[model samples]
Target: MFKFNETSPRKCWLIGHRGAMGHAPENTLASFICGQKLGADMLECDIHLSKDKKCVVMHDESVERTTNGHGQIRNLTSSKIKKLDAGSWYSKKYVGERALLLEELLDWIKEQKSCLGRALGLAIEIKNEPIRYLDIEKVAIEIVKKKKMESRIIFISFDHGVVKRAKSLEPNIPTGILYREPLADPFKRAKELGADAIFPRRHLITKSLVQNAHKHKLFVVAWTVNEVKEMKKIFTIGTDAIATNFPDRLNRVLSNAVKR
Candidate 1:
């Protein structure tokens, strides 16, 4: 397991948000591979249960935005979802990339680790909310356990119940709450829900917020920050990690900062 507690103040983690979405199609295997190749310390992706109950990798509940197919993810069977063109919308270079099953991605990650000789972290966001998919958390947990990547994976969600359920099912797996607006006592809210971390929108992150989270033994991971200036600011404020659409850009900023 990648230990968030062991992170140094100066060394913040650069997480690939939706597998370097700025570079490749979001939530596809190609994008995740691009993120790893670009030196991301961690990668983040969204998961939703298909009609047939298989875990599918996609950020949107609907496939219209990211794929050649249209309709809610839960309404489509894994066979139908797998046949959609998931990459052409992004670029011709990624044309044949299809939506990946969660298990497929996990297997690929394990192979990558063996080749790299290091463990890579993954933040999986459960997208079952407003219309809950029954036992999605349990299914996801079982998959992670089967892969023996429990320590390398962290579960996060905008739904408080989902976060709570994840912790309840597997207390050892790190869970987090994702919020966009400013919350009163964010750390306290997260702690009360049994979350180990708080994932806030980039602009919502402040030095005081990071300090407060650390004070409560909760880590702060800011999301979707792609600009060099914003990356530098978040780094200065000392977030535990910055989730970005461009891991390469963040890596460059970190390298320059180190040189300076």
Candidate 2:
């Protein structure tokens, strides 16, 4: 259901995880902007709805790690969340950065995609559970639909239940299954969830696993691959994309190697 841009190369796509997190504060607008400038094909981010049902961009359940504020993101209003300095804790240069609403991020992506003449997409990881939040799937889907980005948005979640719920809400929207451990059959799990993609840790992507996942018509994307040697292994394993913090390194590697 998730179609990549026609202009994208056949080789592994390089997505900037948490918006080139290695270069800037993770999950902040500054980081996302910098990643886009640094040649990221897709910007990977986590999304959670605020108390007022506004989609907010963040990585952690708690704000204390990345922002000046402390508490659950859902408990805070847009105005209250905006007031916290999200970047200063990471570096002084990023001191004034604040949490970006999903709408704001989508606006920035629209402008960037137009300016760059490329198909920029969002790999949104849903961080809420229905048990924890009343209607996370409904709110998340509403925002993406409102932005008209359902075509470009890939909904991913570590929680399989959430992924299933998303698919139920909008069967047309593409979804991905995120995993940290080696499942007995990742392919089966993905198929069960109706996922278009299977996102797993770098070490878990074996050659056989890739082949099996692709056989099921699931795009396989390995996460946080930053080293060149490791990158090569993933390529050998045949992933559809590699989520990395160093897009520049991946670009340089590709530039050096000319396919025979």
Candidate 3:
């Protein structure tokens, strides 16, 4: 897995927020590939169980937002979800793109690694909010284990319990706590949750939060920062990673920052 180097600001990974949502539809294979082509070091996506208990990629429990289909993800089987056009809502060029199963993505990543001689990281966000997927952590982690891609993954979730469940199931895979509200001693709480990192909403990030997290040997990744100015500001705060929809833009900013 590509990790951050404290001495090199440019090594702070660009985690593609929903697979470079600014360029392609969120959470589809097309989006993930676009992120990689645009210079993202890690592809971040959300996962939920299908009616048949297969792990599928999509950010919501419902497919309506990013798909040309209707119904809750858990109510639909994997085969049914696979037929849904997951990219048309974003652009006509991506009309035929379908939602992919987790295994399919893992296989693609493996292929990419062989072809490029480098591992591309994946941050699978466990979508256990508002509704829970039964045994999602075990199922997802089991799939990663089957593919032997544990080292390249970092599981994250707003529901800290779900993230904790991931740790209990697969101690080898690193986990992170996702929070919208600022926590008291963010690094300490993340460690309490058995997480190796903390993912804070961009507004919740402060210099002290990054400093304290680094002090505890925990890393901070700020999320959904799109504007160039905001990206530069977050970069200046010493975060280990920045999750963004416009990874291409973030790449340009980081490149310029490096030159200076």
Q: Which candidate comes out best when scored by lDDT?
A: 1
- Candidate 2 Cα lDDT to native: 0.80
Q: On a 0 to 1 TM-score scale, where does candidate 2 land against the true structure? A: 0.92
Worst 10 residues of 2 by lDDT: 1-10
lDDT of 2 by residue, 14-113 (tens): 6889998989998888888878777677889988878887778888876789999988878888789888999999989999998988888887776665
TM-score for each prediction?
A: 0.95, 0.92, 0.95
TM-score of predicted structure 3: 0.95
Question: Lowest-lDDT window of 10 residues in candidate 1?
Answer: 110-119
**Tens digits of lDDT, candidate 1, 1-260:** 35868773237787888998998999999999999888777789999999999999998888899999999989999999999999999989989899999898888776664112357788999987766889899999999999998988899999878999999999999999999898887877888889999999998999999998999999899998988999999998988889999988888887777677
lDDT tens digits, residues 100-169, model 3?
9999988887655311235788999988878888889999999999999998889999999998889988
Global lDDT for candidate 1?
0.87
- Give every collision pair in model 1: none
lDDT order, best first, reads: 1, 3, 2
Q: How close is candidate 1 to the true structure, as a TM-score?
A: 0.95
